[model samples]
Target: MGHERVHLLKKIQEVEFAAVELQLFLDTHPQDQRALMEFNHYSRELMMLKQQFEMQYGPLLNFGFSPSQYPWRWIEGPWPWERQY
Candidate 1:
């Protein structure tokens, strides 16, 4: 993987963390519109980043979330634990 991909993955992790935190907060404060908005914003950002990453590399998911140019690209890369990033 390249530097840019690592950066994007890190960003996705950060955004996902924030979204999960907001979800927990919303669980206690279901009436809080502000927290809901923030969660939605982060979710959208995360989706876009995931899409970009998949386009440049391969599917981040095990299923067919993102299509690949090569049919077998999904199994071509190093396993997740083997990746340096």
Candidate 2:
């Protein structure tokens, strides 16, 4: 795999984990303003990272999560998430 792709995937994974963790924390402690702020930050960052990945390497999702491009994009082989480390 290319270095750029690997780097981006790793970063996306980290941000995704942070966002989900913060979300769970907020669910249990809704009064924690700092956690809420952090969650929001990570959520936005994750969205941007997904967008970047999709724009560069095709859809980062499947089953209608990503918009279809000309010639039906996701039908191609080796999706972004399918790359081996």
Candidate 3:
């Protein structure tokens, strides 16, 4: 993979972990304002990261392509099992 792809992948993985961490914190301390803030922040970051990844590499989820793309370019990337993250 190129440097851009590697960087994006690393960033996406980092954001995913941040989301998971926030979820775990919120699970035990559901009313904590700081945890809630962090959760929202990470969630937004994840969305932006996913969008950038799709715009560059291909859709990681379903909504990014059009009917004109036919079979969908989303499937072009590494499959679920093929992905490490």
- Could you say which candidate leads in lDDT? 2
Candidate 1 per-residue C-alpha lDDT over 1-85 given as tens digits, one digit per residue, 9 for 90 to 100: 6677677778878998999999999999999999999999999998998888778777777766667766767886754324475
Write the number of the candidate with greater TM-score, choosing between 2 and 3.
2
- Candidate 1 Cα outliers beyond 4 Å, as residue runs: 80-82
State model 1's lDDT: 0.80
Winner of 1 and 3 under TM-score: 1
Model 2 lDDT per residue over 27-74, tens place:
999999999999999999999999998877778788889886786778
TM-score of each: 0.84, 0.89, 0.76
RMSD, each candidate, Å?
1.9, 1.4, 3.9
Which stretch of 10 consecutive residues in model 2 shows the poorest summed lDDT? 76-85
- Candidate lDDT scores, in order, read 0.80, 0.86, 0.74
Per-residue C-alpha lDDT of model 3 across residues 1-85, encoded as one tens digit per residue: 5667777878888999999998998999999998899899999998888777766666665553422144567567564225443
> Which candidate leads the pack in TM-score?
2
Off by over 4 Å in 3: 62-71, 77-85
lDDT of 3: 0.74
Could you tell me how far off, in angstroms, the CA of residue 54 lies in candidate 1 after the best superposition? Answer: 0.4
Clashes of each: 0, 0, 0
